[model samples]
Target chain A: MTTGTASARTRLDPARRRTQLLDLGVGLLATRTLDELTIDLLAERAGISRGLLYHYFGGKHAFHEAVVRRAVEDLVAQTAPPAGGEPLERLLASMTSYVDYVTANYEGYASIVRAAQGGHEALRRLHEQARNVLTDRIFTEDAQGAVIPDTPATRLAVRGWSAMTEELVLTWAADPGPVTRDQLLAAVTGSLPALVDLLR
Target chain B: MTTGTASARTRLDPARRRTQLLDLGVGLLATRTLDELTIDLLAERAGISRGLLYHYFGGKHAFHEAVVRRAVEDLVAQTAPPAGGEPLERLLASMTSYVDYVTANYEGYASIVRAAQGGHEALRRLHEQARNVLTDRIFTEDAQGAVIPDTPATRLAVRGWSAMTEELVLTWAADPGPVTRDQLLAAVTGSLPALVDLLR
Candidate 1:
C-alpha cells in the first residue's frame, strides 16, 4: 500500500509541474517579446525538465497561443460596457475601462497585441469579439441620437472611433506621459459627435 | 607594400561588412519578431564571421536599435506631408501617402512598432519625430478654425485625432475591407469640421 501511494504521488507531481510551467510561461510572456522567449530559457525559469516541458506544451507556439487567449479574455472582460448607461456614456465608460486595463496589464496586453499581427485565427476571433461589443455600443448610441448615423456611415464612424481608442491606449502604454486617463477619455468623447455626423 | 595594401582592404571591409549585416538583419526584421532574431542567425544570413559581426554592430541591442532607426527614418521620409495643399486636402493626402507607405512597407513599419513597446529612449525619440510631423499637420489645419482655442484642450484634441488616424491606418493595413481609398478619404474629410469643433 505504501509503495502504491508513493507511485501515485510521483504521478501527481508531473501534472502539478505542468501547471506550474504554463503559469510561468504565460507570466514571462507579458514582459518579454515572443521571439525572445526560448523553451530552454522557459524551462530553466520554470524549474522543469526540458523533456517534460515539451510534453506539457507541445512547443513554444502552442504555449504562446494559450497566453494570448487568456489576454483576449481578460481584455474583453475588462472593457465590457455597463448595463444601463446612455449609449454615449456606455461607450465612454468602455473606452476608459480599456485604457485602465491597458495601463494595468500592459505586459499581457502588449504580448497579445504583438501575437495578433499574424493571421492567427484565435487572435482574430478575439479581435472580432471586441469589435462586436464596440459595435453594439455604437448602434445603441446612434439610436439614442447620441451618435448620428445611417448604416454605412455609422459603421464607418464606429470603426474610426474604435481605431482611435485602440491606438491611444497602445500609445499611452508604450509611453506613459502627460497623456493621462482623463485626457484620453475626453479626447475620445470629444470625437463622438463628429463621428456620428460623419456616419450620417 | 603588400602589407599596406592588405591593411587598406581590411580597413574598408569593416564598413562594408556593417552595411551588409544591417541589410540582412533589417530584411529579417521586416517579417520576423525581435525575439526570433538571433546574432548567430544574423551572422549566417549575412555570410559573415561572428567576429566580423561583433566588430560591426558591437552587440545585438545596438544592431536592433540601428535597424529600428533606419526603418523610422524611411517611414518618416515616405509619409512626410505633401509639399503644398489645403489643410483638409493635405491631411487626406498625407493619410493616402501613409496608406501607400504602409502597404508597400508594412513589415518594416510593424517591426518599428514592435520596437516602440520596448520604450527605449532611442525608440521614444523616433516616436517623437513621427509625432512631431503629424502634430504639425494638425496645427496647420487647426489654424484656419477661428473658434478652436489654442489651449490644452486643443492639444489633447489634436493628439487624439492623430492617434485615431494612426490606429485606423494600422488596422486597415492589418485588414483591408471594402472601404477603398476614396471612401476612406471622403469619410475622413466629412468628419474634419466636427473634429475641429470638438477642439474648440
Candidate 2:
C-alpha cells in the first residue's frame, strides 16, 4: 500500500477502522487460507501494528471469525433464491450463482470449509448458519408457501444435497478436468429434486 | 480386577504389541472422536505408560494416523461392493453396507470426515484412499469388465455422490428424526443411478 493509505489508517473512526481491517482480512482470504492468516500478517498488510489489530478485534480468532462471517454473509446473499419464480427455476438459478461465487472466491470458500471442519467453534457456527440459509432456500416458497413439506427427513436430504454441491463445486473449481461448468451445475441441481422426491 | 489384560501389555512381542495398541486405539474411536483420543487417554486405557506409547508410534500424530488408518481400512472393507450382481443391486447392497458401517462406527466415521477436512496430511490421504476405494468400486466390474467407463466427469459425479452420502448418513445417524433407516438408505442409493444417468 502507498503511504497515503497506510498512514491514513489512524485517521478513520474506530468502527470504520475495524470494518477496514475486516475488509482487508476478507481480501487476504482471496489468496490465503484461514489457518495461514495470522494477526501479524493482517497487521503488516494493513500497514498497522499487531497491538492495534488486537485492539480492534481483541484477538486473532475473533478477527478470523468476523472476516469469515462477512464473507459468508456475502455468499448467502449471492446464492439466495429470487423472490418470485418457479421453485425449480429458482433452485437452478441459485445453484448457478453458488458455483460462480465459489469459483470466484475459491480460496475464501476453501478457508471457510477448513475452518468449519477444524475445531473452531465460531467458524463452525458460521459455516452451518451459511449452509442452513442455502438449504432453507431450497424449500422456502415465496408465493407457494413451501412446496416441499420441510420435514426432518426432507431436511436431512437437503443437507446431503448441500454437502454434495460443496464437494463438487470445490473439486471441480480446483480441477474441472473433463467436467464442464454446465455439466457440473446440472449434476448438482439435477440430483436435488431426485433426492427430495425420494423423501416424499 | 484380574489384571491379566493390563499386565500382558508388557509381555507381548513388538508386532503384537503394536497391533494391540492400534486395536485399542480403534476400539476407543467407537466412543470418542479422533480429536478426543489423546495419547494420555490411550495410554491410560491400555494400562501402559505414555513413554511406551511414544516408543511404539514415535509420537502422538503418528499414532493417531496409524489408528485412523486401521479404522479406515475396516470401513473400506465393510463398505466394499459385493463381487457380482446386477449393477443396481450391487449398488444398493453397497449403500446398505455403507450406512450400516457408518452407523456402527459413527465416531470413527465422523473423525475420518473431520480429519479429511482438517489440515492433517496423512489422515486426509487415508480418507481419500478409502473414498477412492469405495468410489472406484462403483465402477469396478468383477466379471463383466468395467461398465461406467470411469471418465473424469463420471468420477466427479461419483465423488459428489459420495459427499452426499456422507452428509446424509452422518446427519441421519446422529438423529434419524422422522426418517426411517430404510428411507435414509433409499434416498442415498436411489440418487446414484440418477446422477450417473444424467451423464449419459
In terms of DockQ, which candidate is strongest? 2
Tens digits of per-residue lDDT for model 2, A82-175: 7767877787788899999888888878878976875677888889888887777666653353446677777887898889889889998989
Q: For candidate 2, what is the TM-score? A: 0.88
What are the C-alpha RMSDs, in order, of all predicted structures?
8.3, 4.0
- True-structure lDDT of candidate 2: 0.81
Instruction: Supply DockQ values for each candidate.
Output: 0.17, 0.62
Clashing pairs in 1: A35-B35, A35-B36, A36-B35, A153-A199, A164-B164
Whole-model lDDT, candidate 1? 0.65
Report the C-alpha lDDT of model 1 over B44-124, residue by residue, as the tens digit: 886657877776778877777777666666666666666666666766776677777766666666656545534455665
lDDT at B90 for candidate 1?
68
Candidate 1 lDDT over residue span A1-200, tens digit each: 32686575456665676666666766676667656667887878866578777787787777666556655666677777788766668778877888887777676666565455333556656666766765665666457564555465456567777766665567667775645667667666767666655435
Q: Write the residue-wise lDDT of candidate 2 on B1-200 in tens digits.
A: 23587566556789988998899999888778888888999899988799999999999789889998898787777777777777767777878988898788898778778877767878888888888888877776433423455778778888988988988999988887768888887878788777776653
**Worst 10-residue lDDT window, candidate 1 chain A:** A112-121
Badly placed stretches (over 4 Å) of model 1 are A1-160, A166-187, A196-200, B1-47, B118-125, B136-150, B186-193
Instruction: Score chain B of each candidate by TM-score.
Output: 0.73, 0.88
Cα miss at B58, model 1 (Å)? 2.0
